[model samples]
Target: MRLPFPSLSTLPPTLAKPPRYFPTLISHTSTTTTPYYRPLSRSLSHPSQPHHPQANHSTTPPPPSSKMSSPAPAQYVTVTPTPSGYALLTIHRNPVNSMNTLLWSQLQAALDRCEQDPNIRGLILTSGLSRPVFTAGNDLTEIFAPMTSREQYARFWTVSNQFLARLYRSPLITAAAIHGACPAGGTAMSMACDHRSISLHPASSMGLNEVAIGIPVPAKWAQLMATLTGQGEANRLCGFGKMVDAAEAKRIGLVDSLVDGEGKEVVADAVRWMEKTLRLPDVGRVITKAHFRDRLSREWEDEEWLRSEAEGAWEMLASDEVVTVLGGVMQRMSGKAKI
Candidate 1:
């Protein structure tokens, strides 16, 4: 039977790009009808950058790229305040830049700093270096970590949602420089910002895939998407776990515009947009942002509601459905199951 929405397998070539960057494989024909494989990419000769386990095993892939080094401890999330009036928050988590509790805490601190500083009129969020993933959502390993108590789980969700809520309602203008595979939590963060500029590369895509993995999308997250892309598109994208590339994302208003290159170039594009936004009157910008986001602000401020939502997040993680779905995802990630 045909499916209404395309699965990863049946999606068109445009939508079939892998979430992670893999080395390209070269093959030659032989009389035995078996193809021999060799990996080729610019990163192969570079000794500094190590390849992750899941590369090159997929059915043919892209060429090898440059080596990406993990930044030192103090560089995880760099907050650089410019003299010209804006702060840049660069996400530097290495080996797929996944968000864990620590990163979220650091991010929250950065946002707080930006908000409090009168000189910092706006903020920009982007990956620190030239890496494949621009914050590969929540670090799945961390999310699925053993929870000794429901309170532990609730606390995790609370801090995460709090950061997002802060970003969504920040008086300063915010923009996301999304250059790579931005899914799940990453998508939510991008949507929370005022503007998003995604890279114009095939691998650069963004969407909320929480439901496909059996976890419900938080109500605040759903509202954020609906606020950005309208209710119909938000419903389709969230419900189906649909991932779209940069061009289509722009067309549907998931992202504001597309940047030409990856890494620093994407960050530069976003900074330029933020600079433009900052040219407007600060009072007008701040007031307008609060006005449109009043509903979200109200919801996040409701103490009981916040606690209940956090508890719901914990319960979902503890559910058997999420466990089984995560198992399947792990299988696929480990090359034990076909996509």
Candidate 2:
């Protein structure tokens, strides 16, 4: 059966072009209108800095790129402040915002900075661009690249788990504003947030399909799914690799609120509802989120279990069947892949 949405080759507006190098830090300055991406300065002392202590042991400046005599234009993740002291964190990774290792690291840094900033109260995770997809999910090219070794796969899980854990444990409220196909890791991402508000786009498909790729879902992600929809439903969905449309997702309680249109107005309505209906001081919001997420954390501390699980999953990915299936899907959509 043909999928309702076009293949990934047709780029959507949300996916930003690739960065020349991964950002060392991403900060949303309260003074600025958008989040800024910058290389980590040697003077930086915070853990939030994208410069992994393990990777950068020297003080030498990065060599200038010969490809560009001129500095590349600064790319910013759009941030809009809300009355509740929270800011909407829109992913502007133009075409489909498929999550990659570098983007995931940048997002981790961004969230860390958001948590530290006293001016920021919470976050609303959404796509800045109109979409056939909020996130097409993980960037399979990066995941299956020959350069991506077993160790790298393990490290990817470590970074991803920690990043997601931070989101779940954040003191501030975080809500996902989902619109289109939110599959695989994208589903995990939405579940990491405190709450979710999705648009009822008829084309939208949201679910976990790891099994179809010959991989088991990460333990933390599986637990989060169970927490949201209960053990029975989580098992049925994850086991069979079911993909549910927006209406079914809503009926099954997978999505909190589904708006009529896919536009800024829909997001505005949700933000307004959050401001008015979610009692302020935000302490209650934080506490309630913790109540649900603590269980997931307790099960995956240090992310040891998740790392081990992902390693095994990566091994399965080495199989021809898994590689062929995933590659064919991605290749068909290559033209549409975000630049």
Candidate 3:
């Protein structure tokens, strides 16, 4: 079944006229300040506009600048509470929904709102684009050295992973509907969810493709993938940085349900699947999820360990070799330099 994208006119007033920057919200009770809001765009990317990357890591500050200029409130994400007792929290950072620091915070804001609300029984996470790209994953700026400071990279690492940890442990039912390419950070987000449904659309594929970009998949992210797809399979997939197509993803148990449609249909099916989970006793389901997933969240909360990882990520980004590779990839993605 095809579910039409929600137009601003038909959406609730809150969404139609979203507050400037999505308000600061707490993830696991810790507040984050991420100022951004971009009006939605439909195309993958146009040269006239800024390019979004499918890069890894997050944040521009490995060493945050005190004089950091705040971006205008960008609407990279949206939330629509459905009558079906679930809310659709979309990642709409157009041009492939790159997981930048701003997009991450906006998403966390939306997720926190849902988790705080009693009326919402579940959250369905999906991309909001006419095309099939679920999310191109990490925004390149977060990973690019010349463009990002050590402080900024540090923040990106923290916010991005923290959001993933929170999603993994969220009490509300969390589901991912992947209608297209999902790699690295994208896989991290979906794998953290309680369940994932992917479109069998020809263009669709999902995996942890970090190595291909000259990066190691974060240990926690690899562990989460391992949890879902088994240690052995995850080892193969992650080690090779394979972005598996729908059939392989299903076969490997990387994603739970395989919807035979694109865009709205894929997400619609995920909603249906989540509804069944919501029908069960909430307390029981929430507890069961925690029993299996809480350990990861606790580990993310380890300041010393997280800082060490961030430092490592920072060191890598600062390396000349990785910088050149990322720049080349960015040039190709932005249509500036062809492969």
Which candidate has the top score in lDDT?
A: 3
Q: State the lDDT of candidate 2 residue by residue for 217-295, as single tens digits.
A: 7667787788778899889999988888878887777888778878565577557655664556544444444555555
RMSD of each candidate relative to the true structure:
20.0, 12.3, 12.6
TM-score, cand. 2: 0.74
Estimate candidate 1's alpha-carbon lDDT, on a 0 to 1 scale: 0.69
Window of ten residues with lowest summed lDDT in model 1: 20-29
| Best candidate (score: TM-score) | 3
All candidates: TM-score: 0.73, 0.74, 0.78
Question: Please, what are the lDDT tens digits per residue for candidate 3 over residues 282-308?
Answer: 655555555566667779656677789
- Could you tell me how far off, in angstroms, the CA of residue 224 lies in candidate 3 after the best superposition? 0.7
Report RMSD for candidate 2. 12.3
Expressed as tens digits, the lDDT of each residue in 1-339 for candidate 1 is 331433445422212332211111111121122221332111111113434546756655455555543444333677788876887788877666777676777787676555545567788888865666677787665555353357666666777787788678776789998888898888989988888988887788888878776677778888888987899999999898888888988999999878888777888888888888888876445545555674575576456787888676677777787777877786677732211
Model 2: CA > 4 A from native: 1-76, 145-147, 335-339
Q: Which stretches of candidate 3 lie over 4 Å from their true place?
A: 1-71, 335-339
